[model samples]
Target chain A: MAERILVLAEQLEGQLTDVTLELIGVARRLAAPRGSTVDALVLGEGVSALAATVPADRTLLMEHPALRLFNPEAAQRALEAVARETSPWLVLVPNTSLGMDVAAAVATRLGWPLVAYCQAIEERDGQLVATSQLFGGKILADCPVGTDHAVISVLAGAFSSEAAAPEPPARIERLAPPAELDGLRVRAVGLERPEAADVDITRAEKIVAVGRGIESKENLELAEELAEGLGAVVAASRPLVDAGWLPRSRQVGKSGLKVKPRLYLALGISGAPEHLEGMRDAELIIAVNTDPKAPIFDVAHYGVVADLFEVAEALQERLGG
Target chain B: MTLAVILKQVPDVVEELAIDPSGTDLDRDSVSYVVNEFDEHALEEALLLREATGEDVVVVGVDTTGELDQALYTALAKGAQRAVKLVGDVEGSWLSTRALAGLLAPVIRELSPRLVLTGVQAPDDLDGQLAPTLGALLDWPHTGVVVGTELADGLVRVRKELWGGIMLDLELATPAVLGIQAARATPRYVPVGRVRQAMRESTIEEVEVETPVESAPKLSRLRAPEAAGRAEMLTGSPSDVVERILEILRARGLY
Candidate 1:
């Protein structure tokens, strides 16, 4: 039998996530060089439609009503079982919040070396080598996992979803969750979306994005006014969205939205590499930061070293009502 | 209940980092290190637990740069009941997650803490793998990207951040590790006077830990990110800056 590369496909609300396909895409690349075939392991009720779309050589589906909502302990149990059955060369999972929670446990249960948040994978001298960023992308490390079985959770957006090509519907197989999941301790109560994002900033010609420097939720109106004056949409970095000051769709970053606006105006943003990756393509970049040395200034075409509130008001006044 | 908070010191991102001449690691002579932002939140979470339930919080760190003693002292000043520094072969934080996990599992078992907390991810190692690896090594459950948490009836109710505005409310049993993203509130600040007092009164306990041989990722090169664009620095009055912005926007036919 050909060595197999197993991918743990993630799904939500009965639909597959983009990161799942990205994982498959990475698995395909890693497997192609080894003469290995890729397979997908999906767990959720009524998920056949979603699993069928996996472009792997085989799709292993474990459907159960209890899995409609993700429970890490239960999923880990299922994945542990799947690993034992296939004894795959490597298991690839997306590095999302849920994936991170389960992948570690599965690797531990099976006693396999695991690498998390990998950015690139290359086969070197019959060994699987994965590269991942450390220290907030300041350093990249190349990890070599010996030919022995290993599990890897890949960073989201590190591989392009476009790289995933659809193949003939994969061969389907049914698996079973462990008979006893008593060892599993964590249980997910529910999924909550506090606010629905209403704006799509990807198509915006101009975007005004704010970061933690904005200070308070009330101050978001200042960004809104500036965005309004510039005929731009209002967006934010991850912190603002995490704090619920803005909806998820308005978040512009690796885990949020990747935007290529014509003009990008940043306020109080420190320009973390992840946030910069999403907006570096703007034709005209403007930044307002209180600190003159903020990293955001490096990419801004025009920079203001002053309070964002003061800058927003002055610009709003200059543009008139 | 005892809780272990793992603290890591990262190079202050505010300062410019340069690659060493060898191009294999960060230029250490010019770098100043500070507590990682999220680790502060983890410390704050432990302190909050101390405040609420009077749990003993033990702050643990691998002494990498010989600077961990001062960090542990700061943690003592902030409310950690005990501080420990693992005193050998930290290798400037180059140890792989597996190595670190191997080292911590023994310490955690000796401490017998009900919970272990670490920053969701370190600024340098944005991988967020340490906590989970520690959990796996200990054969305990672990969760990451946790923003808020509560303890009730010997269970941890955590609010985990999922992608795209989704939040998962999970109940994890005791002896679990949490990769804390933030505390329930901002980390409490300690005055210089208190830290100085701690320096005089507290001694960081040293524990020698031996890690098994392990393979770490190879860093072939290190370099600064290329500038995507250059900014025209704007100075002067706020009105001047605003007017300059307007003129440029108008020239570009934007507004």
Candidate 2:
């Protein structure tokens, strides 16, 4: 039998996160060439119905009270148990905030080559190669998994899932929880979500997102006026929210809402991978950064390599109609 | 009770980073090094946690950079109780996350801290693996992307962030490892005078260890991303650029 390719199916609040679906999508592509099976490991309390929805060759479901909430220890133990039994040739995990807690532990416990922040994984001339980001997207390294077995944590939004829905798993097996879960050290106490925002950036037609380049809270006025002139909502990157200059509702990134407005006018934001993940799909992007090599230019439709304040001021003067 | 915080020095990216002649690493001679930003957050979180719990704060680091004493002295100056540097054979080499974890696991076991705190990610840590790998090697509970932490009755409570601004509260028993994303407050800036005083008054404990075997993907080559950009560059003065941008918006019906 060919070795299986395993994907750790992540879930929250009874729904499979988008990254988990994306991981399964990548695993299928990797498995077809080797005649290997794609197996998805779904772990959570009341995850049986959720496990059945995984689009893989087989879905291994492990449900326990301790597994209901996200417990890094229990999840790692479950994944280790499954990988030990299946002896998978490759494992795919999402490199999101939740999945990072489990991915490295799997590699450490199984003694496999780990490719984190993986953008793509493929077999090239009989060797597995992963293209991953480094230094927040300044460099890309083509890493060869020298070992036969490897663990990859895929970056969210790297693989588009617009393809027709994959077939649901043909087989679903319920597995017993690992004995170690009974006496685990980590326990989930609660989940808290921010109250609904007054403005949903995701629904906006146009957005003016500010980054560190906006400089200070007082300078946010530049972005606000430009956004108002263009009938766009004002959004921000994580640093502005972290600094308390903007509310969490206005933040965009891996830890904030993803938006795809028609026009994304980015100011002073050197695009980090996290910030790019949220708004890369905007219909048209115009970025102004003093550094020509800022990663934002890679995604922008129009690039201005000058002071953002200067550009914003000029644009503001022209927009006064 | 003791709280262990690990620190490291990374090349400052604000300064230009040139690829070394060898092609496998950066040119170390020209780059300036600073303490990893997230590790500074981890140290600050430990200091805050200690304020309520009154546990000992011991900062540890593997001296990869030759100038480790400056970072250690600054840590001591900013309220750390003891500073330990793992020295000797492991200097000047980039240890893979797995190897770094193996090298530090035994030393951390000796301290037997109630909590081990480190940064969630470093520029080189590809998806931030050190804290989790260390936790697994030590067989302790681990969590990352932690924003806030509070010491509760028998367990430490942490606010672990999920996607889209959602937060979860997790409790872990003693002897846990956490990768701190940010401390409740900004990292305290150590005065140069305090750092100088600490250098004269404080001594860093040093231990010698061999290089642990590294298990990592063979990095084939480093290259800039294929500029898949369709961005039309607007040159000339800011007014000219802004005028062109307005023309683009009008063309796209965005104005």
Candidate 3:
């Protein structure tokens, strides 16, 4: 039998996350050499609608009323059942919060080797090796999973989703979760969605980010004004985000979004490596800070050493927005 | 209710780490160590739980090196009643999940902590394997990156931070392992007096490093990333600078 790679595709209210497609892209890379096939396992209420989107040879759908939202127990049981039946060579998942939980639970249950936050993976010496960042993006560690069945969670945006060619005929299979998990004990009561204002900036282009030098919440308006003038979005440093001045989505750092945008402008931002990891892939990076030695300058394509407010006002006047 | 907080000493986040010429391990000489930041939140959560319930709290450092004394002392300053360091040689040891599970199984059996808390991921390796590995060994319930937690009727109710800060509330049975996220709580600073007191009383026990069930994976190469060129200083009158930036962006296809 040809080797098989399983993708635990995550979705919300029936809509597949972008990370799923990204995983498919990664799976394509891993499966191409071995002539292996990629299978996407989706679990949720009304998840059959996503069958058309997944780029897999087969799409396994487990739809139940209890799974309308993410029921960890049910989801795990379903994925585990599929793994038991398929015996895939590797299991791929996104490194999103839910993906991380499912991957951890599944890996633990099966005693399988797991590599998280994987940016890249490739086959070597008949084993799969993954590249991951360590020491908060200061070091890169390449780890190889020795087991025949390895599980990995790939970071979002780590690999670009390639357009499928000569699209394969996707087949959908319905699965019933295991029944012995009755006493799992965890119950979900409610779900709360973040306000619309708190959107993830990693997906955004033309970002105007503020750092600690912004002084106060009142000064945040200046950055916002510049953002508005540029028709851009607003983001913040870890300190501002931790202080709740901005939503977690707008926080750019190692712990936050890993973004690649068309234009990223840093205003009064002292660049920390953690913050830069989230935005280092920006096509054009412009930093404005009074300190000449600010670390942000190291990655910036353009640097301006000046007062942020004055610089903002000058740019606003020039743009005349 | 007795609480146990697990801490790990890891490499500092800011250092530029290099791999040894051997291509198999990190160059330890160039790195400095610090308590994993998320683990600090785990310690804080334990302290808060103790304060709320008036329960005794013990901090345990799973130290693979004698150097973890500094981290253990820091935990003591943060209000831990006692600190125990599990000393062993973890270097060049793949420290596979099976081995870790085996080692912690005995400790959990002996400690019998009502709840065990650890960081979601350590900064040095960022493998995020410990909590799940330990949970499997003890056959306990496990939750990762929990933002809100409550203890009631021997059950642990937690609000997990899902993608984009979406909240998923769950109720788990006691004797569970929680891998806490850094955003869960504000870590408390250790006091000077407490540090001095902890240094005097803390006892560390060295244990043999468990042999990994699987051998260390081979590394083909290790190299530092090439440094990018210095940024171009776009200096001119304000309008001219803007025009210059626009030109650069356009040429670079950023526009």
Candidate 4:
């Protein structure tokens, strides 16, 4: 094995995840400088087609009935087996829900240094360096992996998926899951859908998102009025959703829906990196926050440094409602 | 049965954080540390479980940055029965998940806790690895981003938050690790007087854990991310700001 970089390709519902391509993009950047080849490992039943879509030098497929769904226990077993065989220089896992669940355990099992939520990767002095956001995105730490073999979970939307050039028809190889898949300590009991109907925020053209600045659950109606005036759908940050003021479908962030709306009217959102990762690419962003120094201002196209309640009422009146 | 809750102190992100002279770390002298928001939720979850099942809840704090003692005391005020602080110079800048996991595995084994609970992720670490790494070191089953948990028939049933609002319902046997995303309710408030009383009455049992000899990754440099695009700030009264936004939206043909 001549300097291999293993990329874990994440997929859902028989389609490759968008973050999977982004991981491949980061892997290419890290590997190209070192004359290393990027190989992708995709585990799922009947996922060979999805694996072939990976833009890496090769795609390793682990297909089995137990691997059909992305329960952590099954995925970990399959990844550990492949990782043991190929001691790759670096393994890139998507920092998605499933990726985060398995990467740390796998790295620990392999005795490799694990870097989580890596935002950027660079080659310094022929060694790999990873940059991660710390202190709620207030600081960036440039970490140089001390060990030769390391596992990294690449943050979603950190790198543009377009940057990864598709290889000339990636070669696919098949592997089998371990024989004793029967005794899983944790079993997936099936997906529990949110109580509300799924309203895909990704398809929304314009959105009005709320955060902790809303102050109280009763104030949600004010945000809704503003959203109704603007002809935009209402959404919220994790705080509001966690408080049960809004359904999970209306939440936007790393652990929530990643949306690229045309106009994102962020009402009182502080623009934590987790939230920014979701709607950073909106064509026009207008933020209303009392704190002028809010990180939301850093990315906003237009901002109002005022209380959200006052701003929402003013906006509602301005929209002639 | 005993439940262990791991607590961490993170920078108070609401306050402005400044880079130190070295440009590789935060200026600790001027900065204030608060218990990690999620870890507080973890402690609250442990307390909730304890309240329901009468299990003993012990808080383990890694006193890496000299801020863990305060958090431990707060945990005591909130409801933890006992607290243990791991005292050592863990070399903050060079600390990696692997190093922290190594330091914790032995301590966890010593406690032999029936369930280990920690925040799903730390603002400082963001890798969301500590709980899972500790589980792997102990070969115990673990789950992350757990939003809801229930106890039934001596098994822990957890609801995991997956991407796009999908939830995964899982059941795990004891001697398991859980990275709590949120508590069932907001952490109960500990009044100032109660906290002061806890400070005087409670003692943090300090255990001098040996720092690992292994070399971990070091943060070579730190830099503020360059602004992606110049933000056109809107100023004036609230009405003027709203009008300005409307004008821009109309110009973009979005309104």
Candidate 5:
């Protein structure tokens, strides 16, 4: 019998999280050496359609109204049922807040060893080991699971999404969650989705981000106008987020969204490693700052050594934006 | 009311770290250690909570190594009433949140704090796993990235930061574990006078506990991430730099 690895799939409303696909890519790599099959455990209402998208040889779909909103208790019971049935060698989960909640509960109940935020994983000496960056990516730590069964939560964007194999005996099975909604002590009374305007920066292909050098909120209009003219979005460093000048979502750093775009224009942004990690993937980076020795210049494809206000105005005129 | 804050002593994040000559572990000799930054925020939250409720707060350090004494003492200087250190030298690989929680559950059970606070993620692990694992181990409620917190009617109302700056208001029963995110309130530095007093009077109670099982994730191999595509270095006056940038942007079809 070939070893099997199970991936716990998460969905919001009807769309799968990007992490699900990333986990599939990870599982494919983990399973290749052992000729193992990947199985996806999806729990939610109206999830049969999602089964087609899971990159697994088999999918266990648990459909229930209670599972719709990611109730931890019900989700745990459903996963426990699947684990009992499949007995996978490893259980892979996304490292999102929600995923960690479920993964922790399940691992605790099963008494299985777990490694969280794994950046890399491999089998060595017939035992699985994983590596994760520690100290804010300053130090790397290598760990090995002592138990035969291991649970791991993978960081988002650590691996790019890969297409699921064309077709290979894909089977779907329904599981009835063992717990009831009423049994869940914690309930989400309401969910407030951010308005499109609030998250607009995440999708903007061209972004104009400022750092502490921007000085004050009154000067923000300079950055905003440049963004407006260039048809770009405005973002900020952690200080701006702390200052309430920008929302936390618009804060670009290791703790914030890792963004990749066509063009990233940084203004007065000193390139801290935390900030650089988030935008290092952008295709073209342009930095404008007064200081010639700003670290931003190191990663920037293009840099302007001048006052940001003067540079923004001149660039706006030249680009006709 | 009593609050407990969990903290870890991790290598300084800003310093350049080197691996041991053995290539199997960090070069501990050269690395300076500090309290994990997030844990500082957690400690801050614990102090704030104590002040709000006039509760006695005891900070506990589950030290797997003797190195944690300084961190514990620092927490004491910051306002924790007492400190408890668990001693062992378990390998870094066995330091997963689950394993750490297993070691901490007993100590926490004995203390029986009304609430436990931790950093959303440690600067060392950055996994953000500790709070959830501790919650599961204790069968308590867990909340992550909490920006605002209030105690009302014996329940904890936590404001969690969701995607895109939205807040999720959650109410959990007492005996909850909250992973605090950095908020508008900056963590205060320990006053020099308080540090001196704490060092003079504070003595950490050492609790010897069984070392956690070695469950380090195996690392097959590691290499630095491939260098990003090189940027053409432009050296000239500001106008010349601008012209060169425009030319490059146009070449890349940005214009």
Candidate 6:
């Protein structure tokens, strides 16, 4: 195999994810600058046929029974096997739930340096420089990766997945699974889908979403009162859900639920990127936080820097609560 | 059988983080430290597992911030059998996640643990690489985003969440590494008095280990996320703010 930009194509339940295309798009950009080619790696049992549409210079599809499902152990082995032989200068993996599972392991296995949570990748002075987010997107760090081989995990949504006007890879190579996948230490027993939300925030017309600023669980009652006045559903940020103050169904964020209600009343949510990704499209956004710098204010159309308790209480009173 | 939980002290995000003169790291002098949230969850999971299986739970951490003692003592107060602090400059300009894992892997292997748990992700190791890196170095299977774990015959059954909140049940052989996202239950709160007593009684075991050769990604700059500047400020007291909010909603015919 020739040296090129390698991309780990992501798929779920036999369908390729849009993020994989986004990775390919990024891989193309990174490869074009240096006249390097791009190779997409797809590891699965019967999903290799799906690689026909990958927008790369070449596609290397590996298959094994252990890869019938998305097992990190098997996926890592396949990626490491391919990377060892191809010796790609740059490898891109989607910074997603599954990608997070395997990217670091693959990099470590290959003895290559890795930069995770990378939102931007650019080569400077013949060196790979990546801008990665830290502190849940509160801070951005631009760093230079190793000179030799580097693995980059690209976060989704940084680039659009418009399908690149439909250009498929010209060459496809089918490879046998490495013997390492024969008897994996880890095996997926089964998968469980998320339980139906008690009240689906996605369909709700109005939502009163509270965050850490709610302080204690008792304050949730204030949000409830305000929600009732507005005929809205009650929602919360990850902290409120993680603390068990609110049910998971009512949580709003990357790991929670994406909601775009008619009106989103954000109280005390710092609006981490994960949280913002879930609810930045609300028809009307009103945010209240003690800190004027809260990212929620950036997304909110009308912002107030005030104590959440006072604001919620006053809003309830104004609404005849 | 033992479950080793790795603890770390990260800059408390609540504080105003100031970039150091290096422009790549935080201004440590101004920042306060707190237990990494996920590691606390890791310890909580290990403790919970120990409560059921009677397996010993040991807490270990690298004293990068020089404040690892408080975290270790609190772990002891919360029912860990022992605490280890690897104290030394493990070959780095700073303690990168890879270096921290390299430094701890040898010592953890010496303990002969059945399972090792750490936070799935920290602000510093936002990619959640500690578990996988340690696993790779130790030649053990590793997984992240794990929420629940149970001990069975010779392996551990874990409940992990995949993308879009899909849950999956997987079984990994013993001597596995887990990057815990959350525990089955909330972390138990130890009384301040209990922590004080633990500090007075328990002694943290210290060991010196030399990390193998590794190159870490060198950060060149750090900056705050750019604000969108889309918000229209609504000023005044609580009542006035509420009035403006009501007016906005009414304009959208939401009321």
- TM-score for each prediction? 0.85, 0.96, 0.83, 0.93, 0.80, 0.94
Candidate 2: TM-score? 0.96
The DockQ-based order of candidates, best leading, equals 2, 6, 4, 1, 3, 5
Computed on C-alphas against the true complex, the DockQ of each candidate is 0.45, 0.75, 0.39, 0.64, 0.31, 0.68
Question: After superposing candidate 3, which stretches have Cα over 4 Å from the reference?
Answer: A64-66, A123-128, A145-147, A163-166, A198-206, A211-234, A253-262, A267-283, A287-321, B91-102, B201-220, B225-255
lDDT, candidate 1, B1-255, per-residue tens? 798999887788767777779776677777889988888888998888778778899999887667887888889999898998887766465565666667778888899988899987765552236777788778777888888877777688888877655778889898889998768777888998899999999888888977556534344555554456457888888889888888888899988
- Give me the candidate number with maximum DockQ: 2
Would you list the clashing residue pairs of candidate 4? none
Q: Lowest-lDDT window of 10 residues in candidate 3 chain B?
A: B217-226
Q: Assess the local accuracy of residue A1 in candidate 4 as a C-alpha lDDT between 0 and 100.
A: 33
Q: After superposition, how far is residue B198 of candidate 6 from its true place, in Å?
A: 1.2
- Residue lDDT tens for model 4, A1-321: 348999988887688888898888887876775788888998888777787778898889888776777778778877888888888978889877788878998988887777787888877886667888777776677888743788888888889898677867798888767764667777777776666556667888999999999999999888888878877899899988887888888889988888888999998898888898888889889898887667788788888888888878888887765
Tens-digit lDDT track of model 1 for A56-166: 889999987667788776777788888998899888988777788777667766878776667788776765678765555545666676556888888776778765688
Q: Which candidate achieves the best TM-score against the true structure?
A: 2
| Candidate with maximal lDDT | 2
For residues B1-255, write the lDDT of model 3, one tens digit per residue. 677787877766455566777776666677667777778888888888877777677777656544677887877777777676665656534344445556666776677888888887665433445676577567777777776677777878877776554677777788888888754456877678887877887665444545454533334454443347446787866677777766776686644
lDDT agreement with native, every candidate: 0.79, 0.85, 0.72, 0.81, 0.72, 0.83
Instruction: Give the better candidate number (2 or 5) by DockQ.
Output: 2
Which whole-number lDDT from 0 to 100 does residue A175 have in model 4?
76
What is the docking quality class of candidate 1?
A: acceptable
For candidate 3, the iRMS in Å is 4.7
Q: Which residue runs of candidate 2 sit more than 4 Å off their true CA positions?
A: A162-164, B215-217
> What is the per-residue lDDT of model 6 for residues B1-255, given as tens digits with 9 covering 90 to 100?
889999988887766788888787777788788998999999999999998999999999888777788899999999999999998764223467777787888898999999999998888773337888888888898898898999998899999876556787889998899999889888899998999999999999999766546424457788887676569989998898888888888888999
Compute the TM-score of each model's chain A versus the native chain A and list the values.
0.81, 0.96, 0.78, 0.92, 0.77, 0.89
Candidate 3 residue lDDT tens string, A1-321:
448999998887777877788888778777787798889998877767677667788888777766777766566667778898899988988776677666766877886777777777877778667876545544556777653887887877677777433268678888775663445655666678767655557677788889888979998988888788777789887768766788777877655566677889898886754577578788878998887666677788889887888777777776664
